[model samples]
Each structure stands twice: as structure tokens, then as C-alpha cells.
Target: MANKSVFATMAGKLLPRTDTRNHEGAQAYSLSPRQALAQLAATGTFNATFYAGAREQLTEVLELAWQVEPEFLAKTAVFAFERGYMKDMPALLLAVLSCLHGDEFGRAFPRIVRNGRMLRNFVQVMRSGATGRKSLGTRPKRFVQAWLEQASDVEIMRAAVGNEPSLADVIKMVHPKPTSAARAALYGYLIGKPHDVLALPELVKAFEAFKRDPSLPVPAVPFQMLTALPLTREHWVAIAETAGWQMLRQNLNSFARNGVFEVEGFAERLARRLRNPDEIRRARVFPYQLMVAFTTADAAVPKVVKEALQDAMDVALANVPAIDGRIVVCPDVSGSMSSPVTGHRQSATSKVRCIDVAALVAAAFLRANRTARVLPFEQAVVEIDLNPRDAVMTNAARLAAIGGGGTNCSAPLERLAQEQAKVDLVVFVSDNQSWVDATAHAHQGTATMQAWNKVKLSNPQAKLVCIDIQPTTTTQAKGQADILNVGGFSDQVFEVIATMARAETGADHWVEQIEAITV
Candidate 1:
């Protein structure tokens, strides 16, 4: 017989070496520069996470931006905004692009900075000198000028709500040559400069008129523009009637506090609208966002409204694809996962935590694939039964309320191997900072890779995916033909996971998707 202990299999020798340490100081493999950029673009909010601060994230992103091709950076900005539904990182990437003279930056600018908040973020980042330039420069100035010239009156009006390098500030710095008298007046109005009031656009005129006379019908403006006025029940009712899906969802408590729900039939009507399938689809609503609204709603909010958010979650999770084979999803419920999903900002920290997103992913998988198993893990596999028939939000809440010990990324996989479990796909949703499993004797590769190697012995065709919910440059499992390391909390991730599980892709599937992006 061959010396089985002394002579390892070819696969054993082929296991990639651990090259770096995770935030927890665990053995991990560093991602390639391009891979790191994509991951950061999808997950970095420039806010402080449990491990990295806002400044550190900003510095790392800039470092990676300099390492990749300018074209990749441009495509990434578009991808982050359009698919990932991210705000800050996309704007930052666009700001970085603006410093270069290439057409990629110019092409990506209009697409990424599509609205007021984005425009403000772009200008703020540029002026802060974070992207190697403090000024918009000649070409970027042209883009800014074009944006001001081309935007419609209403579009520009809606853009007037946010500040801190406000649209007004951007206008002053860029000095956009307004193409029409209305636009010129609008610019002056935004910047508080004297202008002919008669030249104001109809929407602006309507807003001004409504401001002057409370009895006048409420103008269809941003919710922020209406808050200062002494609004009556009728005004609040009118605001609810015209508010968009997102605005209504976020301000449910505010509406309740202002007695909008007290109006007979208004609460029921708003509830119906909240759960409307068309509106849910049209809003591109994330299931977790609905979860946030459901969780954060105050006691004053109506019962029907909360239930409607639950229904909206069902409609929002339509993107969770059904996989064809046995699946096991392990959601990390460890201590570090308690940090906010978008990280911690002083006043703007997200209520949704990394654990909530992980649980949501696992619950979504179980809902889509009824037979799929869920193993919520912390220091080890914390066994918990989840019903597929239950609502995604319910199952997610149950899983999210589990253990908060050290992270052991290999625990669930180790359990599967121990039981000789057969799985076609194994998904691990985590922060990818597993320190409990990094033993002194196991220096060749991560404990996750070791456990995965064992699982692969029995099921050679199985695939593994690590869905990272935080911005980090390392992973427990290195990318390979059967392993995928992707990040993001958006439903866009579901499509890639489904494609990979169906064997429609090879290694670098995530990178391939980003590379295939057109400018």
C-alpha cells in the first residue's frame, strides 16, 4: 500500500497558499487588484466598519483605483451605481475618473452621477482633493456645465434638496452657462442670487405660490421642501398621495407622527400602494430595505402599513433565483457581523447589519429553493431549523437573532463533511473575517479551504460561493474553477450565483461580468 499519510493527493498540493491576514488576523488569501476593486466598489460605503475606518476605506479604494486600468474604474463606477445600488463609492470612482483625460471618465460621468445627490457627492469628493485633484479641471468642468445645461427644470428643482457642496455650491464653482432664461433664473434661485421671478419655471412658480398661500394645493416637490411649512391634515394627505415608493416607505413614521394615518381610509390606501407589485418592481426595492422599514417603524405607525411592508418584501425578493440541486447556506451570525451593512457613519449609519443581510441571503435561498438547508454559524455550526413556507423576512429575523461568538467560516462545511452530506452548491454569507479556525499547524491554506477540500472529496462537482458583505481585500477561499468570491447586498448577486451554480461559468465569473461591461 502507498504511504497515504506521507504522499498527499495532487489536489492537496494544488491548494493555494495563504498570503495575508484578515481583519481578525486570520490566515487568508489576498484578492487580485481588479478583484479587490470590484469588491470594494460593490460594498464600500466609505463609512467605518467594525474593522476599517472611513479614512482607511477611502485610502484603500484610492490605492486600488490607481492600480487598475482607467477603463475598469469607469466601468466599475457605472456597475456600482446601476447594479449594486450604491451611492458613495460610485461617486468616488467617478471623481477619480474625472482626474484622467480619457474618454472613459467622461462617458461614465453622466451615467454614474445621474441625480442631485450623486452630483453633489461627485463635486464634494473632487473638491476635497481625495482623488489626486482638488479642482474639477477643464474637462470635468465641461461635463458639469453640460449637466446643468441639459437637465430639465423639474430635474434641477428636485436636485436642490441636498447640501454640503450643494447643487448651489457646484453651480457657483462650475458656473454653468444656462441655456434658457428659466434655467438662468433657476440657477440664481438655487444659489440665492437676485433673478427675475417671472422667469422661474412653472414647477418653481407653483412651489413659490403654494409657499405663500397654505390654502393652495401642495406642489409636487421633494418631501424636504415641504417640512418647514405649517402643513395641515389635508397637506399631509396630499403629500402621501403623491409621494414616490421610496419616499413613502422611508417616511411612514414621519407620516404617522404628523397624523397622516389618522385620516380615514388614507392608511389603508397607502398600505395598498406599499404592497403594490408594480410599484415594488418599479422602485427596484431591495428586500432588506423593506426589512429596515418594517423593523424601524415606530409604534404610531399603523398595523396595516407594517404588514404591507412584509408583502412588499415578497415582491422585492422575486430576484432570488431557484437553484436546481441540493443547496446549503451558512449565514455568519458572529459578533463582527453586528456592524452596520454600510458601515458606521456618525449620523447616517445604516440600521441593517451584516448579519441581517447574511440571514436575508440564506432565507432568500431557502425560500426560492424549498429543500435548501440553512446552517447559521458563529464559533461553530449553530443548528437552527427554518421553514421554507414562512416569509423570507420571518426566517431572516429568526436566523439573524442567533449566536454572536467568534467567526468560524469552516464550521458548517466541517459539519457537512462529518455527516457525509451531499450538496450541489454550498453558499457562505459572511464578513470573511474568520479567526477561530486559523490554527498554528494549518499554515498551508485557510481552514475554510481545508474543510472545502474534504467536502470536495465526496462531491467533486459541487461549487462553493462566499458572499462577502463587507469591504475587504482577502477571503477564506481563493477564487478557483469551483469557488466564487463575490460581494454586495443587492439582488444583482443572485443572478451571478444562479449562473455559477448551473455550471454556466468557469473561474473569474465575477470579474468576467464586470469586464464585459460596456462604457
Candidate 2:
């Protein structure tokens, strides 16, 4: 495991190299937009350089979408846009709009443009396209029609058209006649006119017909239209019943506000969905969701709802593979990590911080590995006891107790070496901004490298995994053979670990293993 160049290989493939330039015979690579977004999302700090770099990268990615993997490009663009951290909305908007009109935009645009503000941008960008040199193409037209069919807001659609005489021709060319009641409503809504009252029965009938076909996509159109209907409690119940439990879980707040929680059998239905393994895995329920539920759920809600959330967390983590040997989970609870995970504005109201994310990652490992030890670190380290059965949020709270100091990345390895602890793996969950003790000259290299080498003497097969939560200008610790660098929290980390455990050779093979599970 210690004989491969995993970090360099993975970094080369995943990190953008466009930033690299010849600097006096040496290559200097600035952080890519993807990396910048990761840093911003992790630390929630305002960095002008990273912001400008990210804006440039976004434009580059959008223009080159035809040359890149659509899924990867879409994920990068959508994640950055949705994080709402960037101060420059217009640049982000243009980048998002370009991606939407790019090849294979269908895979992501629908999911991203659902936000009202983003949808407005879609209209504005389309208007710009109509008047500008670029023509308003079929793809954008199709997206607008589809979005209108799902969510028919007369004002928004009119705003999209905006008396652009050229747009009327495009709308007519794309949608000449209404094929269904939803389309009829959309056409009527867009033209600033109302459809016949008789269309209501047909819409309901169409919705009911679609509800019976499991092969069909979820009835997003009918669900959205329901908000405007003057329906009885039974009608709302029927709509909820038709949408199924998965949709209901994602919109718990809406259901609660609509008094759907008071509906009989609602709690039982939710509980059953939470316990379903397939649903849990598909939803990818994480600690963030649990924290949100804890912070946002009303006091009047039933206890069963809380229990269901806990059950969902358990089901989500049920499949994590346990480590085979002694493992140490080191979570960096430094002041830097206490910054909000998204943006400064969000920090004022958000309970999630980078430290919380690190703690959650540590808790995940502790829950999976029976013999694992957890050390929360900043300038120093403190041992904390944890039970596998403890809830993830509980573990995070305990880990968050140790905070407010500079990050000394070498402390954990140095401490383990001094104590003669025979550890097989050391997982450090941090942003990797380790400058506190990094300047010290040591036998191997940096302080972290020297300490890691000393620990390796006692445990030659020990592997180091740095779960980098942010982007850094500093280079990471190098290893002879057994070191891995991963960003963010996902199942991808475990896949890399499993590959290394099999003693996989060659950087290409490792890259393939990681990329296979990327999406």
C-alpha cells in the first residue's frame, strides 16, 4: 500500500491543471474553481483571489462542457451555484445559464433551475440570448416549457417572455398547441390569460392517471399545481398518498405546515420509509440532514418524527465497512474550522461549521470501527470516549467541545509515536492548513512528515488518510507508499481505502478506482 503515488495521481486527475504556468522553469498552478468552491464551502471565508479564480473556472467549464464529462461538469457547476457563497451573482448566473444550454444540460439543469431566483435567471438569460448574437435555441426553449408545465406562475412566465416580440415566435414554434391540461394552463399562464374552468377536472384526471403508472417519473407538475388548488383535506391527503413517502420525507417542513402531520397514519408511513434500506441508501442521508431536522423541527411535532430521523441515520450508515485493525480518528476542531460551512450570511443562522463536518466524519469512522480511538485536535489533542450506538449529532457535539486554537497537524502522529501505540490507520479530518508547527525542520521533511516517519518505524504498514475539507496553497504530506488524500465526505473515501488495502499498484489503476465511484 505504501508503494504507490496515490496523492499525486489523484490530484493530477481531479484537480484542474489549467492554472499551471511556467514560472522561471518551475510550474505554478493556482487553485481551480472546483478547489476554490470546496475551500469556500468548508471555511465560509471571503477570499477575493479564490472568488475571481472560481468565476474564471466556471466560465471555462461552461464553454468546454462539450469536451468534458457532462455529469462531472454539471455537479461542479450546480454545487457551486447552490452553495450561494459567491458575491458575484451575475457571473455565477451566466455560468449556470451557459451550462444549461450546453450539451447534455438535461441531466442537471432541471434540478438546479428549480429555485425561483435561478428560474428568473433562466428567463433573463434567455431574453439576453434572443437579443444578443447567440440565438435562443431549442434546448432552452424545451427547458422553459418543461419548467412552466411543472410550475405555472403567470407573472414569472410573462417576465420570461417580457414583450420580446422575437420570443413569441420561438414560444409558438416550440409549443403550438396544448397536449395536456398542464400545458394548457402553462400556455394560458404565459400569455396572461386564464384557462377554462373545465380544465380543472381534466388536470385531476390526468394526475390520477399518471399516479397509477410507476414507470412514469414522479408527478412534479401535479404536485406543484396542488398549491394553487382549492382542495379539501381529503384531496391533499390523496396528493400526499400519490407522491409517496420519499417525496414526503424531503418536504417535511411543507407537510408539517399544511397540517399533514395531523393526518392519521402519517407517522407510521414516515417511520416505515425511514427503515427501508433501499430508500435510506438512495437518499444518502447524512449527519447534516439530522442536524437540520434537530434545529428546525417544531416542538409540536410528534416524537415519532424524531425517532424516524434517527432510524434514517442508522439505515444510512448500516453498510459502512469496518476497519480490520486498530484505527485512530483525529478531527481538527480548530478556530479556523469553526467558520460556517457555506457563506458569511449563512453563518449567522447556520448551525453547521467546518468543525461540525470534521466531527461528523470522525463519528462515522468511530461508528464503523469497533476498536477505533477518537482524538479531537487543534494545537493539541484530547482523547474522547465514544460509543458506536451513540447518535451522530451527539458525537459531533462532544467533539465540538474542544475548539479555539491553531492547527498543529503533526501532534496526533507524534503523540501516537511517543506512546508507542500500534495503529494500523490514522484518519485526519481537517482542512489541511497546518502552518503552526510546519516550519520546524525535521529528519524526513516537514514536522508532519518527520512525525509520520517516526510512527511508521514502529508500525510499518500504517496508512495515513488526510480527509481534506478545504483547498490549500501548501502541498500535502508525502508518504513512501501508504497515504491517501480525499475531499469532502462521501462513499468514495471507502472505495479508495479498499483499493489500497488490496495493494493495488499504478496511479492509473487507483485513478480508475476513484473515478468509477465519482458520480
Global CA lDDT of candidate 1, please? 0.88
Q: Cα RMSD to native, each candidate?
A: 2.2, 9.4
Q: After superposition, how far is residue 449 of candidate 1 from its true place, in Å?
A: 0.3
Candidate 2 structure quality by residue, lDDT tens digits, 1-519: 565533333211122222232111112223334443333322222221211233343344334433445454555444434432222232233334454445535655665666435555555445554224244466666776666456544333333432333334445545645667765755554455676545544434454455565343333343664465555455555666666445655566766767777888876776676567787666555555566665566765567887787777666656555768888889999877885553244224455667877887788777777678988888888767788778776887788767788877888988998998998888888767665664422222455666777788788888887776543332245423576555545444555555555556322222233234322
TM-score of 2: 0.65
- Estimate, for each residue in 72-141, the C-alpha lDDT of model 1 and write its tens digit: 8988889889888888899888888877767988889888878878888888888888977888898878
Q: Which 10 successive residues of model 2 have the least lDDT summed? A: 10-19
Regions more than 4 Å wrong, model 2: 1-185, 190-201, 204-247, 250-265, 344-350, 440-446, 470-475, 478-481, 504-519
Q: Model 1, which residues run further than 4 Å from truth?
A: 1-13, 441-443
